[model samples]
Target: MLQHLKDHSNHEALQLQLFASTGEGITLYELESGKETFPFYLTKGTYYIRIFSNDQPMKYSFTSSFSKGDNFENELNNTKSTAKLMIPNTTFTGTLNDGGYDNQFADVDVYKFEL
Candidate 1:
C-alpha cells in the first residue's frame, strides 16, 4: 500500500509515524516527514496513524485498513483540528476476447498461452 501525507500546517517540521496493530500492542512501521510519502507492504488488517508537531502528538488519531494495492492520502491542515485522510477506491475494467474458438468447453471462456 502507498501512503502519502501532506502537511499544510504552518509548522516547518512535522513528524509522522505509521503503526500497525498487533496482538500485544502497536508496531512501528515507518517514520517520515509530514511532506513525504511512505510505501509499505502489509497484510490485510487495520493500522494506527500518528502525526506530531514539535514533539507533541495530534489530538485525533487516524485509523485505516491496509489491503493489497490500497492507496491513501492524508492531509494535515493548518488548523490542526481539521485534518483529513482520503482512501480512494481502485477499480479495473477490461474486455476478454476468446480467439473465436468454437470448440471451447463449458465455463472455460478464457485461455492462457505464453507468447
Candidate 2:
C-alpha cells in the first residue's frame, strides 16, 4: 500500500491531517523520495484534509498516474499575479523551499491555466 501511494505524485502532503473519510483510519505521511501516501482503502464519499504548520513550509503535488510527468520549474512565482502558466493534463513537480524560505514567512507557489 505504501509503495502504491508513493508512486502517485498526487498522494502527497506535509504534516497533513485527514478526517471524515469514508473509513475509520487516517494515516500520517511525510515527504519521502518526493512523495507521500496514505492507506488507499475506503469508500467513495466526502473527505476532509487540513494542513497546518508553524515551522515547516507546505509542499504538495498531484498526478493521476505514476508513469509520466515533468518536473516543476522554479520561477519565483509566489503570488497570483506571477503565477506560472501550466499546460492542461500535464504533471509537474515542486517543493515549498525550492523558491526560498524565511522563518518570518513560508514559501508559496502559484500556478495558472487557460480555459
Which candidate should be chosen as best, given TM-score against the real structure?
2
Against the true structure, what is each candidate's TM-score?
A: 0.30, 0.34
Residue 7 accuracy (lDDT) in model 1: 47
lDDT of 2 by residue, 13-114 (tens): 345444555543243344443554443322345666554433344444543223233445454678889987898877766654321123323556799888
Q: Over the full model, what C-alpha lDDT does candidate 2 score relative to the true structure?
A: 0.48
lDDT, candidate 1, 1-115, per-residue tens: 2222444355334444455575322222333333233344444577665555553443323434434443322221223344223324443221221222332222121222233
Task: Score candidate 1 by lDDT.
Answer: 0.36
The lowest-lDDT stretch of 10 consecutive residues in candidate 2 is 96-105
Q: Relative to the unseen true structure, what is the C-alpha lDDT of residue 73 in candidate 1, on a scale of 0 to 100?
A: 23
